[model samples]
Target: MVKVSIFGSTGTIGKNVAFTLAREDTVDEIVMVARPESLDKVKGETYDMYDALAARDIDCRLTPTCNFHDIEGSAIVLISAGIPREKGMKRLDLAVPNAKIVAYYSRQVAKYAPDAIILVATNPVDVMTTIALEASKFDKMKVFGVGNHLDSLRLKNYFSRHININSSEVHTRVVGEHGDHMVPLLSSTTIGGIPLKYFVEYVDLDITGLVERLKNAGNTIISKKGATEYGPAYAISNLISTIITDTHKVLTVSCYLDGEIENVEDVSLGVPAVISKRGLEMIVPIHMNDIEKRNFMKAAETVREATYEVKEHMNM
Candidate 1:
């Protein structure tokens, strides 16, 4: 049995994550925390979750609170508290405020649940993840952001649609910034263990437009819907379940690097990493072509700059 704590349980992603984890038999308890102002809403969401679980006859204990102390003994503390991006806003546009929010909660996590693995889902997640790592003073491996995992899922979907193949057979990755400069690792993508190039020689994959569409996918959803909910929810829950089960799945996520990849350090950028019960087990070194390398470095710089800006904004 595992106890998980969600810092922003009232938001769309948080709510979705709560419901998804509730269904997981490994997650025996969830502590849903909201700000004092949203205490009532969180309590209601908890009751609502209880009702849903009862309907399905799943016996997961759920608690809602505005108190940070209640998060004690949690094995996972997911931080999703931040301003949701507006239609026209870039993810970086949320850096300053979200950094502050993440920092505050990181400290609380450190105090109440220092052993917990921190999964940051706030907007501008890469930057917020770095802030969380610093503020919580946790080992870098224990703190990670959920962005590239979601991006990779989107990449897989796009590949499946264009190639008309089963999505399960399409293995692709998107690294670097989870934002505009994310690098779609076409160099490493495979379909049923076959290199993408073999198929590219025959099929018109429209690689250029594919990356553009992948980059804009999140914004496109945000433009149509108020905010993205289910995709991230499912992706994050999969990650959580993997951790609880010690599956050690290799997933692309934003994790800190210190010579794990060339020339990138002290920043959280999206890359493929092995996820285990201990949190980030290792950052897998995948091959990248010249163009993919250049774009990935650029994305690293973009997130690094934004991370610095957030630090300065928060006076950290």
Candidate 2:
């Protein structure tokens, strides 16, 4: 039976993950982990979530991490426990506090679920995911972050909205940092194999404004809802399902770069990668235009700067 562990079970993303996984037959057990202070609170919500699922004829073993002992034997460890970005907050600003939380849990996860796949879902994800990778001392292939996957989804959704088509008809990938530096590859993006420029002309759309909105989609949602959850929640669920089913699908996720792209050394950035039961199956290179190349490089620097900003707070 496949057992999955969620480290921030009480948070919005974690709760959403729990509810989504509760209906997945591939998941035989769902372990909800929380800090000791939040243990009882999460346990209460766990039962509430699981009971509701049960009423719908969905069932899975629900466990709490009051002791954190049962994190062992989990097939996947999703680290969503960290400082969330608030209104008017830049993702990089949450780096320090979230890094501390990520570091401590990364150590514990390394000690407990050493063989499990580690996926980070925190803000400034490029920085925090790298922190988790280094702190856990795990092979880079064994860990990653749900970064541009969410960004790409948002990009596709926004483009699809403008064209008045189902998002599935759009084939797009957003790369680079998961923040303001993200690059939505227009050269490589297509709609039903149609170039983005074709759609802009056909729809008489403003390309520049559309790209800006795509970049700030997160802040846009958080401004009204106080949090952005639905898109990320389902994005992560898709990743989790891909892993559970061992589907070797390429997703725009955050992984280490050791010459994958020149000049960026020892950092995590969002790029095309194949994910399967083995975690990072492979990294795929995207053909970039001159402008995209410059932007991708700038994104690398932005990610490194974000990490440096949080470096003083981390032991590494």
Candidate 3:
């Protein structure tokens, strides 16, 4: 029986995560944590867990509470509590506020659910992930951020259309920061054991424009729908499922910096990682072209700058 808790249960990503996990029989119980005043707000939602359980034929109960102490004994905790970025806004704009949120909850998790696998989905994800790691002082392997999974998904979707192949047949990754600095590994992309370049040639298409399009995919969605949640929510769910089931899946997650990528130091950014009950078990380093390497460095620098600012503000 897997016990789980969602810290921002009423928010867009949080709500979708809860709804998705609630449908799984593998999840024994799910606790939705919200601010004291927001409890009523959640209860009023259309697909709120309370309502879902009430209308269900099963005898299981879905717990919702504002108290952190009530969130104990969970195998995993998804932290989706943070501000969403606007279309034209930089993720750094959310640093101060989201850092505070991450710090506060980090202490709470340290106190109440120290062993839980903490999955962070907050904006300014890289910095907030660093804050959580420092504040919680938990094993670095046990805390990670939902970062480039959505970006990788977008890359695969675009590649599928370009190659006229099914998305499931494409294997690719978008590494580095989740924001504008994402590095798409075109060299590593493959369609049924064939290189992406070969597939592109077969289709007689230009793939250069598609790279920029994939990089700015989030802004496009935000411009159209105001905020992006569904894709990210699904990505987070996939990560959580791996941990809960001890699946040890390889995924792109924002993990701590330890000089694994050379010259990149002290920041969280998306890289291919093995996820299991240990949270982020291992960082998988992939080869990069000179341009992709430069972009990855830029992404690392952005996160490092943000981390410095967060430390200055919090005086940590």
Candidate 4:
């Protein structure tokens, strides 16, 4: 059976993930983790969303509990259980508190389901991914952050509209951070195998403004709504699907750095990576211009600073 456990299953991303997976026939068991007091909230919300499907008699199991032991035996664990950032809140503001949560859950995972693929979906995800990796002592490949996948999706969608092309025809990747420092690889981006520069020349689109729009996409969503969750839930669900099915798809996710990209160290940042049954299989390196390289380095610096803060608090 394809067993899955979602930490913070009562939260926006977690509940949406459960709702999405509940609709899938491939998911055999879903364990929802939350506080004991939150059990009814999860059940009520889930039933309210799935009652129609339940009336139709779907055959999937939805188990809600406060116990971490219930997460054992699951093939994948989606860590969406941390504070969501407010409109003006910086990623660093979340570092210390979320690091403690990562530590707590990492110990639980180590004790129970050490073999499960750990998907980090918390804000400041790149840094939180490092905390989870170190605290769990799991293979770096098995721990990854849902980073630029959502950003890349937004970028492609924007590009498609600008060039009047189908979104599937546009292939793009956002690298480095999952935040404002993220670098959109315009040079490597393509529309139907043609360079984005050529497409821009043909369409006369404002490339500079497009990059800024991608950077501020989350802010725009948060400004409209209270928080951004739907896009992330969709992106994370896709990652879970890839892991569950052992699909070796290349995606932009935050993985541990080992001096691989320009000697970047001790941080997790978004880069093109292959994901399969073994989790993150490979970090694919792509050539970038000087400006893009600098942007990536700046993002690495920000992640490193946050890591240092977390480490100081953990005394690690």
Q: What's the TM-score of each model vs. the native?
A: 0.97, 0.96, 0.94, 0.96
Q: What is the C-alpha RMSD, rounded to one decimal, of candidate 1?
A: 1.1
Which of candidates 3 and 4 reaches a greater lDDT? 4
Model 4 has an lDDT value of: 0.86
| Candidate 1 accuracy as TM-score | 0.97
Please give the CA lDDT of all the candidate structures. Answer: 0.91, 0.87, 0.83, 0.86
- The residue-level lDDT of candidate 4 at 258 comes to 93
Highest-lDDT candidate = 1
Score residue 291 of candidate 1 by CA lDDT: 94
Q: How many backbone clashes does candidate 1 have?
A: 0
**Residue-wise lDDT of candidate 1 within 216-275, one digit each (tens)?**
888899999888999999999999998899999999888988979866898899898999
Candidate topping TM-score: 1
Off by over 4 Å in 3: 46-60
Write the number of the candidate with greater TM-score, choosing between 3 and 4.
Answer: 4
Between 1 and 4, whose lDDT is larger? 1
* Model 2 clashes, total count: 0
How would you encode candidate 2's per-residue C-alpha lDDT over 140-235 as one tens digit per residue? Answer: 998899989998988888888887889889999999999889998998788987887776677767779988998888898999999988888889
Candidate 2 has an lDDT of 0.87
The deviation in Å at residue 108 for candidate 4 is 0.6
